[model samples]
Target: MAKMTHMKKQENQKSHFNHISHKEALVLTKIQQIKHQKSMDYWKQLVIAQQQSGFSVTEYCRQQDIKYNAFYYWLRKIREEALESLPQLPEKSTTNPQVAVLSATTVTAAVQTQSSSLKLFCGPVSLEVNEQTSNEMLMQTLRCIKEVFGIC
Candidate 1:
C-alpha cells in the first residue's frame, strides 16, 4: 500500500501541467505564433528560391547548405498543412460544390490522358496531372478518392 501510494504520487507529479498567469500565457502564445510564422516564412521563401533556381531538390539543398531530408520534410509538412486548410467534402455526400464523385470509367479516361510527370498515388487509386489540370479537378479528384477509399 505504501509503494502504491508513492507510485500514485509520482504519477500525479509527472502529470502536472505548468500553471501560469493568463497574461503570461497569452504572451507566450503570441511569441510561439511569431516564431512559427517566422519559420514558415523562411521555408516558404526557400521553396520559391529553389523553384526559381531551376535546381532539383537535392541540388538546391546542396547549393543552400540545407539538409536534403529536412528540406523535403518541411516541404511535405507545409503542403499537408496547406491542403488541410482547403474545404473538405462532406463525409456522406459528394454534392459539395468543390468535390465530384468519379466513376471508374472517368478514372480510366483520366489515366489514359495522363502522360505528365506529376503523379499522385494513394493505395490502388492514382491521379496524374500537369500544369493544365485545373485546381478544381485536382481538388475534386483527391476528395473523391478520400471519400470513397478513406485515403487522402
Candidate 2:
C-alpha cells in the first residue's frame, strides 16, 4: 500500500504541457505557415530541376541541399494523396471484350518490358553500347574486336 501510494504521488507530479499566451500562439501559427510555404516552394524548385536535368531525386536533393529521406517521404505522401483523390474507372465487363483485350495488351507490353530488362541485367548474355558509335559502325567494331580477341 505504501509503495503504491508513493508511485501514485510520483506519477501525479509528472509535468504536463503548459498553456501558451495568445501572442505566442499567433507567432507559432505564423511560423507554421511560413514553414509550409517554404516547403512547397522547395518542392517546386526541386521538381523543376530534376525534370530539366534528368537527374535522380537523390542526386537532385544532394545538389539542392534537400534531405533525401525527407524528400522521399514527402514524395510518397504526395503519391498516396494523389492516388486516393483520383476517381476510380468503371470496371469492364467480360461481355465487352474490346476493353478487356486492350487492358490485356497493355499488361502484356508492360510485363514484357519488365522481364526483358531483368534478363538484360541479370542473364548470361552481356549487352552494351558505345554512345559515340553509329549502329553500322558498332557492328564493324564488334567484328574487329571478335577477330582480334578470338573468343578467349
Candidate 3:
C-alpha cells in the first residue's frame, strides 16, 4: 500500500482578499510595526490593570484613551490565546482557615474608608474655597483633569 500525502495550494490570496491601496498598506504596516515594537510587559500591564481595577472595559478604555472596540477585541484575543497556551488553574481550596477573618477585616476597612470620604465637606479640600459654591465643581474638575492633565 502506498502512503498518501496532502498538498495545499498557495493561491494569490492577497489579491483575492480585501485589498488596500499601497499607500494605505504602507500606513497600516507602519502602525502595526509601531504596535509590535511596544514592550510585551506594557500589554501585560494593560491586561492586568483592566482586569483587577473593577472597571468596565469601555470605561477603562475611555479613561485610558484606548480605542474601545480595539481594547475589547484584543482582550478577547488575549484571553483565548491564554486559554489555549496555559494549563488549567487549580481548584480553590474551601478549607483555608483564615479566609473568613481576612475578608471580614477587609470589608470593615473598606466600609470605614468609604464612610470617611462621604463626610460632607470634612475631608481636606486641596484648594481654599470661598463661601460661593458652584454646581459644576465636580464636572469642571473632571474636565480639567481630562483636558489639562490628560487624566480621565
Candidate 4:
C-alpha cells in the first residue's frame, strides 16, 4: 500500500470513505482504528482490574464511575472477541475431552480410594476443563463457575 502511486491510491480508495479525499479517508481510518484499539485495551484493563480487586461488577462500576450495564456490555464484547480469537476445533476429533466438576469431599474420597501421584483439591468445587470443550460449553461452564466462586 505504501508503494502505490498517489493518483492510483486515490483511485482505489472508494470503499466507505468516499465523502473525503482518499488520503484524508486513509488517515481518518487509521486514526479511528487506533482509537478503537485503545478503547478495547482500556476496557480490557478495567475488567482485569475489577477481577483482581475482588469487587463485584456493580461495586466495580460504582467505584470506577461507569454505568453498570455499560461495564457488562464491554465485558461481553471483550469476552466474545477473545472467544473468536481462539483457534477453531476440528469437527471430528479422535481425542476425548476431559471435563469434571469435583467437590472437595469427592476429591478426598477419590484420594482415599486410590494412591496416585496426581491429586486436585479445591475448597469450593473445581472444574477440570480442556481445549476439547466446545466454546459455548466452556463459556457457560465458566460463567457458572464464576457465579459459584463469586469472583466475577
Candidate 5:
C-alpha cells in the first residue's frame, strides 16, 4: 500500500506540472514581455534625467538614490544604441574633409596674447587652470573630472 501511495504522489506531481494550458502559457509570455518593456522605459528615463540634470553622473545618481554601477550600465547601453543608430561614414570617401593646420609660431602668438589662465569645459563642469598649476596636479585633477563626467 505504501508503494501504491508513492506511485500516486508521483502521478499527482506530473499532473500538476502539465496543468497549464497553451492559452495560459501565452498569457505568461505576454506578461514577461510587458515587464521587460517597463524596465527598459525606466532605464531610459533615468538616462534622460541624468543628462538634463547638469550634474556629474556620480552626483546625479546619488541624488536620485540610484546605484552607480547600474546607472553606468544603463548609460553605456543607451550610448551604444545611440551610436549604432548614427549614419555610418564611408570607408573610402570621394571627397576628403578640409583639415586646418596651425603652425607653432601661430600657436605661440595666440597663447602669448591670451591670459595665463586656461579654462576647460566638460558639459556642466568647468575647470580653470593657471600657469602655477603643477603638471602632476593637473593630470590628477583631469582624471578625477573624467571619472565624474565621463568626459574631459
Candidate 6:
C-alpha cells in the first residue's frame, strides 16, 4: 500500500510539471524577466545613493543592513553594464601635439597672483583651496573630490 501511494505521488508530480501550456510558459518567463529587471534597478539605485552619501562602501552596507559582498557585486555589475553600453571611441592618430613649456618667471607670476588661494583643476571640475588648509585635510578633500567626480 505504501509503494502504491509513493507511485501515485510521483505521477502527480510529473503531471504538475507537464500542466503548463507553451503560452503559459512564455508568460512565466516574461514575468521572471520583469522581476529580475526590477531587482537590478533597485540595486543600481541603492549603489548610487550609497556613493553619494559620502560613506565608505563598508560603512554604508553596514548601516543599511546589507551584505558587503552583495553590495560590491551589484556595484560591479552596474559598472560593467554601463561600460558595455558606452559607444567605442575612434582610435587616436600617431601624431603628437606640440608641447608648450612655461618659464619659471611665468609660473612665479601666476603663483603670486593667486597667493591667497590655490586652484586645483581636475578634468572640468575646479576647486579653490585656502592657504590655511592643512595637508591632511587637503588630501581628504582631494579624495572626496575624486570620488564625487570619478576622476582617475
Q: What is the C-alpha RMSD of each candidate to the true structure, in Å?
A: 12.1, 18.7, 16.5, 11.9, 13.4, 11.4
| Model 1 alpha-carbon drift over 4 Å, by segment | 1-19, 92-152
Kindly list the per-residue Cα lDDT of model 5 for residues 1-152, writing each as its tens digit: 24568888899988976898999889989999898657656787777568768898999989989999998887676556545544454587658876779999989976885676889977656888877777876776676545444566
lDDT of 6 by residue, 73-140 (tens): 87777666655544455787779866779999999977886787878777645778776667766676
| Clash number for candidate 3 | 0
Q: Which of the two candidates, 1 or 6, achieves a greater lDDT against the reference?
A: 6
lDDT of each: 0.72, 0.56, 0.55, 0.68, 0.73, 0.73
The residue-by-residue lDDT of candidate 2 on 1-152, one tens digit each, is: 24568777666655321356688779989999899656655554455456567788878888978889987776555445434544455687888576344588899987676555411221212445434336665455444333322221
What is the Cα-based TM-score of model 6?
Answer: 0.47
TM-score of each: 0.49, 0.36, 0.31, 0.49, 0.40, 0.47
lDDT of 1: 0.72
| Rank order (by TM-score, best first) | 1, 4, 6, 5, 2, 3
**Clash pairs (backbone) in predicted model 6:** none
Tens digits of per-residue lDDT for model 3, 1-152: 66444432224454544577788878989998778535333555576677667898788988999988876666565545445543444688788755344588899987676555422332122333333335465445444333322334
* Candidate number with the higher TM-score (1 or 5): 1
Using alpha carbons, what is the TM-score of model 3? Answer: 0.31
